[model samples]
Target: MTHGFRVASLCLSLGLLVSVVACHDNKPAAETRPAANVDVINVALRDVPVVFEYVGQTESSQQVEIRARVNGFLEKRVYTEGSLVHAGDVMFVMDRKPFEAALDAAQAELAQQKARLVTAQANLDRVRPLAAKNALSQKDLDDSVGQEQAAAAAVEGARANVIGATLNLGYTTIVAPVTGLSSFAKKQDGSYIDATNSLLTYVAKLDPMWINFSLSENEMLDLRTQTQNGTLKLPPIGKLEAVIVLADGSIYPERGYIAFTDASLSSETGTYLIRAAMPNPTGSLRPGQFVRIKLLGALRTSAVAVPQSAVQQGPRGAYVWTVDKDGKAQQRAVETGEWNGNDWVIKSGLHPGDHVVIDNTLRLMPGVPVKANLVATPPAAVNIGGPDGGATGGQQAGAAGASGPAAANANAGANAGTTAAQPTAASGASGALGEHTALYFASGSSSLDAQSADALAAVARRLVAEPGMRVAISGYTDSSGSQAANQRLAAARAATVRAALVVAGVKIERIEMRKPAQIVANDPPDKSRRVDVMFSPAAGG
Candidate 1:
C-alpha cells in the first residue's frame, strides 16, 4: 500500500514540472522588440531663396593717417588711445613757444619795413614838391619814387612772412582730420617730429563699416548658369541687402547693404570681391573683425529646402536621408545653394511630399524601416518674395491685424512675403493658392539685382495678364543716413521700380507710388530699406 502511494506523488510532481517548462517556452514576444523611431519633416515644394553666405571680414570705410604738419617736440597727448574723435578736434599739442617767437620776428620785420617805407615816402613827398617848383631835377624825383616803391614791396614781403609764421604756429597743435575712432599714437610726448614726414596716428571711420568677402570662380560660374537658366534670380546691384553675423553667432543689430562688387575675378585667388556697408553707430564692429555675411535680395524658384541638420556633407558632396513610401529611409544626393538660417536651400534632389529624416540620423541606414514622427519646421525669413505670391496689400493687412502670438508671425510675413504665412509644419493646412515673393534692398539703395529683376518680371507678367490689376510701389530707406536723404532715396527707388514695371509692359498710370505714414528707425536696415509692391485686384473683375 505504501509503495503505491509514493508512485502517485512522483507522477503529480512530474506533471507540475512539465507545465512550468511549457510556460517558459511560450514567453510573450512584445518585451523583446526594438523601438525604431525617428524625427522627420516632409519636404514641401515652394520657392526657396538663393541666399549666399560667405565668411567675411569687416574693414574701415575710411582710414585717415594723422600726421604733424609743423616740426616740433610733442608736448602733450591730448587724446586717449583708441578713442573717438571728430574732424578739427585737437588730438595732440606741440610746444608753441618757438613758433610764436618766429611769428613775432616776422611781425617785427614787417614793422621795420613799414618804418623804412614811411621815411622813403617822406623823402619822395619832399622830392615831388621840389620837382614841381623846379627845385629838384627829374632824375632825383624818379629816384625818390623808386626808393618809396621798393620800401613798400619790402613791407609786403614781410607781411607774407608773418602769415607763414602764423600758420606754422597754428600747426603746432595737431588735430583730427576726420570724424572717427582714433588709433594709438606713434610719436610719444617729448618726441621730435618732422613736419613733412612724421606719422602720429590714424583715425578710422567706423560708421558704414565695410565688410569684404569673396566667392570662387567656379561658384560664380554656377551662379551665372543658375541665373541664365531661370533657377536663381538676384536683386539689382544697389538693392542687394546684407546682414553681418558676428563671431559669437549673433546677428548685428544694424543692417548692411552691398557697397561694391569687383568687375573681374582675381587671378591669384580665383575669386570675385564683394563688399558691403554696415552701420556701426556704437562702434561695436571694428576694422579687421572676422564675421559672416548673409546676402539677401536673391530668390530660388521652385526649390526644395530641408533643415541643415538633415543634410550631411561627405567626400562626394552634400546628401540627405529621405523616407520612402514604404517607411524605409533612403540616402539621396542633393545639390545645395545657401543656408537660410537653420535650413538648407536644396537646389535639387528633393520633391514635394518627400519625407526627410531630421533627427536620429546616426542610427539610420539605407533601407532600414523607420517610424517617422513629423516635426515642425522653423519660420523662414521674410522679404524673400516669389513670382505671383508676393507681399500683397491683403497679406499686409492680415499681418497688420494679427494680434497676440500671431503678430510676430505676421510681422515676419510682412518682411519676407507670403511664404512666412505658409505652413511651417507638415500637418497644417496646404500652402497658399499662389506663389508670392518679396525682394528686399539695402539702405539708401533702390537698384535691383538679378533676383529682384526676375521677381519684377514675374510681377509684370501678372499685371499684364490682368489689365485692371494695379500695383502700388512704395520705397523705404534705413535711418543711418540723414532723414531728408532717406526720403529722396526712397522716392527715387519707387520711381525707378515704377519705370521698370512700365518697361515690363505694365501701364504707367495703373502703377501708384505710395508713401508710408511712419518710417520706423533702428529696425533691421535690410527690411527697412526695401521697395514694397502691393498688388490691387482687377478693378472691373
Candidate 2:
C-alpha cells in the first residue's frame, strides 16, 4: 500500500507539470508582443508653392563673330586674347601701305583731271567768242564744249576712286563693334586674310546673360493636365521669376525674368526651348556654362505632402506606411510628384485625416499593431528666399541671413523636414576628389548638360587645389547607332570634356585620355552616353 500511494503522487505531479506547460503555451500573444512605436503625422491639404528646376545653359545675349571686311594680310593683333574689349577698341591691323598708295594715286589723278577741265574750259571760252565773231567755225566751238564735258566726268570718276581708296584704308584697322569679351585671334599676325578666311575672332556680350533650357513633351502634358484639374496654378509668363544655381551649388545673386518661350516644339530634340535673361553686371556669368534654373511663383493648391523619408520604394512602386482606424499598420501605395524642399508632394493614394508613419517604418507590417506618436505636419511650402520672401502661398520664412540659393536651399531642407544631416561643401569636395565622377551627355551629342558641368567644375577645383593629382577620362556611346558613328561620337565627347577641363585651368599634361571600349548591347542609351573622370595622386609626377 505504501508503493501504490507513491506511484499515485508521482502520476499527479507529472500531470501538474504537463498542465503548467500547456497553460504557458496557450497564453494570448497580445500580452507577450508589444506594438511598434512610430512617429506619425495626420495628412491635410494646403496650398504649397512649387519651384520648377531645370538644367539650363548660359548664353550671351549677343554673341557676335568678328570678321574682316576687306581682304589683306593681317599685320598685327592689337587686343589681347580672352580680354574684355570696349566698342571701337582696335583689335587688329592689316597692311595699310597698299591702301595708302592707292588713295594717293587716286587723289593725284583727280588733280590732273581738274587741271584738264580748267584748260578745256578756257579753250571753250576762246572758241565761243571767235565763232561768234566768225573767226572760228561752229564745229570748233562744239569740239571745245565736248572736251570740257569729258574732263568734268573724268574728274568726278577720279574723286569717287579716291573715296573708295580712303574707305579701304580705314578697313585695314579692324575694331570691335561691341563692348564684350573677345576670343582668340583666328588669323595670326603676318597671316594672309582673304574673303574665304576672314574670320578674326568672336565677342560675346556679358551683361544680361541668357539662360536656355528645354522641356519635354511629357512634362508639358502633365503640367497642362494638372492645371486643368485645378491642382496647379501658374503665374503670368512675364511675372515668373528666375533664379540660377551655379555649378558649385551657389545661387546667382542677380534675379532674372522669363524672356522667351518657343511656340512650337523642336523636331530634333522633341522639346520646347525656354529662355531667361539674368543681369550680370559683374560679368561673373559666361556663355556655354551649365546652370540650374529655378522658376518660382507657381503653386499647388489643395495638395498633400509628406516628409521625403516617409516614402519608400517597393517592387510595385512607391509606398508609405499608414495607421488604420483599428491602430494597425497598413501599406498604402502612393503617386508622388515633385519635391518641395525636403517634403514630397503626393498626387494620390492618401486622404485627409489619415495617419502616416514617418519614422520607425522598418518594424511595420500589414495588420501589425502600432503605437502612433502624432507629430506636427511638415511645412507646406519650402522657403526659397526670393523677391517675395516666402509670402506667396504659405511659404515659411527663410533662415535669417541666408544668402544665395545654396544657403536658402540648405535652410529649407533643415526647417522643412530633413531627417538626415547634410555634408558641408568642403566635405563634398573631398569626397568628389576620391571617387570617379561621371558626366552624362544627350544622345548623339557631345555637349555637357548642367549636371555634368557642375561635376566638371568640382573636378576642376580639386585639380587646382591638389597639384599632385591627375585625372583619367573615358568616354562611352550607345550601340544603337552605327559603329563608326558611335566611335566618333565617343571620341568627340571625351575631347569635349578635355577642352572644358583645360578651360577651367587644368593643364593638358595632367589629364590622361582613355579610349572607350564597345558598350554592352543591353546598356541603356542614356547610361552609355557618359564621360568618367578618375583622379589619382602623384600621377602627374
Q: Best candidate, TM-score-wise?
A: 2
Model 1's TM-score against the true structure: 0.52
Tell me the tens digit of each residue's lDDT in model 2 across 20-136: 999999986666568999999999998877787555678899988989888888999999999999999999999999999999999999999999999999999889989999999
User: Which runs in model 1 stand beyond 4 Å of their true positions?
Assistant: 1-46, 118-149, 195-197, 264-268, 305-339, 342-346, 349-541
Superposed on all Cα atoms, the candidates' RMSDs to the truth, in angstroms, are: 24.1, 13.2
lDDT, model 1, position 505: 41
Model 2 misplaced stretches (Cα beyond 4 Å):
6-42, 109-159, 309-332, 355-378, 382-513, 516-541
lDDT of 1 by residue, 1-541 (tens): 9999999999999999999999988987567334369888877766665455444556789999988888889999999899999998999999999999999999999999999999999999899998999999999999999999999999999999999999999998888988899988888999998856588999999997998766445455556766798777778868988866565446688888898989997653344677899989999988755555656777766667777788898899889998899988899998764455455677678888888888888878888888889887665654322211222212221221112334344333223422332212211022221233345544435555434533454455456545777766666555556777777877877776676555334567887766632346644546565666666563111
lDDT of 1 at 209: 95
Clashing residue pair totals per candidate (backbone < 3 A)? 23, 0
Q: What alpha-carbon RMSD in Å does predicted model 1 have with respect to the real structure?
A: 24.1
